[model samples]
Target: METTILTKKDVEKILTMEDTIKAVEHAFEMHGKGLTQMPPKVYLNFDKGDLRAMPAYLEGKAGVKWVNSHPENPKIGLPTVMALLIYNDPETGFPLAVMDAMHITNMRTGAAGGIAAKYLARKNSKVFGFVGCGTQAYTQFMALSMIFKIEEVKAYDINEGNAKKFIEFCESKGVDAKIRGIEEVCDCDVLTTTTPSKKPVVKEEWVSNGMHINAIGADAPGKQELDEKILLRSKIIVDDLEQALHSGEINVAISKGILEESSIHATLGEIIVGKKPGRLSDDEITIFDSTGLAIQDISTASIVYKRAAESDMGIKIKFFDF
Candidate 1:
């Protein structure tokens, strides 16, 4: 048997935001139905950043992603996050494909936010607010645009250049976008935050009712972006309960005793499967605490693998001689 090797370019050519959203939504539904296996992410700590091992299995597909976050890598002209995924055949314990997962990470993360907004935000949501206009912000916008009209984009970042660049990206997509203060950016129908701030960058007072927030950046312990009070008031939905408490946006608040485990409204999976309701009223404030999930990667990788296989897009190598 041969294993396919897909480079970043190959995977990018095969994956799309629309397909990613569908696959991620299916993964969440399967998770909600208790049909998938996803263990807690294993972590390796480093002085500069960290590495993580994420594994999951669902619907006959299995994979593990080895991903790293090195904050200082940018100083050396490298990306902050990079990843590789090994897709496997569950029955035979054979590697079926090895593919770049960095784009998978971004697309699936953005798809999660879009899925969250689909269920949690009002259908009329059009004004999208982005706090921290980095690469992740672009994918988030792409996913949101898939679901909503996205009449206007409000962007904010400490580095004005990043925000301006994001605005240019939005304009290139034929969407109207402008840079705004963080608070003003929050004054929108759907708000997405992608900052890796230990201290809260968003204020509670600024987050009004009828707003749905995607708290995207806090994927490790001690990282947070939303004010605790905002979490206290908002109907908080997380990708996973234990993971959220350990490393999501709510980790800090939960660790500080400002928030309790019982306060979380539901998992996005539960909402997807209709075990729980979403957005009961337009005046309600909702927050999706997205720590990212392994099922997302595995499911998305499955799509890329199938597309690559059909198109003969990547190189194949036989690793074992029987």
Candidate 2:
């Protein structure tokens, strides 16, 4: 077996926001066509922390990935989440590449947001509000800033320092936006909540007509970013019903009976395909529940794996046996 190694910096040289957007769209198309298989996430529980193992394969696709989410790692000088992507040979099912998963995670997650916005956000959206400003938030900004002809951005994080930092970063990217406290939601045509707060940070009344909300922060059962009322009032969309049921923001809404599984409109994939309509009106409130997906990993790894192979950029390791 020959193995290719890719680090975080390699990922930087290889993938861009545009690449990720294309990759995610392709994954969504494959998903809509039923070309992928993924098991429900397996959870390992603890008092202060929890872990999940997500594995998946897409027929004819050449790689797989395993990723985890942990929001408390920053206190220890580590990232809040990490992932590992393992590419495999189709012929022998042998490992082909092992690479840092953070780049894939950040890019794919941001790409998912862009895809959702392409379908669901108001056509004339101008101002955006960001509820959490972390590293992931930066990419989320990068994705949307490219897709939408955004006029201004308003952002807030529970941590004032982070919010300020987000503003500076956005400015460095040439975004004509403002950084303010959490109260900036009133000015948004699109809103994104990307924090792991246990309590609701986005209130129902804070949402306005014609606004699209991306629920990105709440991946675990008890974590939530929006008030149930916010979910109840919107036409909710999820990546997958089963994944949303257990891991996304939809789980909270369902548990509270503010939303039933019946209330969900469609998977973003369904909207991507011609099967369902997205953002039918200019004044509708829409929400996209992002639990994250395994296909994203496969697609991203395939991109890097191919590039490394063509350029012979990574170290190749040989394994004599399985």
Best by the lDDT measure: 1
For candidate 2, the per-residue lDDT at 236 reads 91
RMSD, one per candidate, in order: 0.9, 1.8
- The digit string of per-residue lDDT tens for model 2 on 1-322 reads 5788888888877887887888788888778877778777777877656666667777656665655555577888877667778877777888888888888888899989888988999878889889989877888888998899877889887688898888898888777767676766555888988988878888777778889999998877888888888777789989988989887998877887778888899989888887788888888999999989988878877887777777778777776564
lDDT of each: 0.94, 0.82
lDDT of 2 at 231: 79
lDDT of 1 by residue, 1-322 (tens): 8999999999889999999999999999998998999999888999998999999999999989999989899899999889999999999979999999999999999999999999999999989999999878989999999999999999999999999999999999999999999889999999999998899999988988999999999988999999899998889999999899999999999999999999999999999999999899999999999999999999999999989988989999999984
Extract clashing residue pairs from model 1: none
Candidate 1 regions exceeding 4 Å error are: none
Superposed by TM-score, candidate 2 places the C-alpha of residue 149 at a distance from the truth, in angstroms, of 1.3
User: For model 1, what is the C-alpha lDDT against the true structure?
Assistant: 0.94
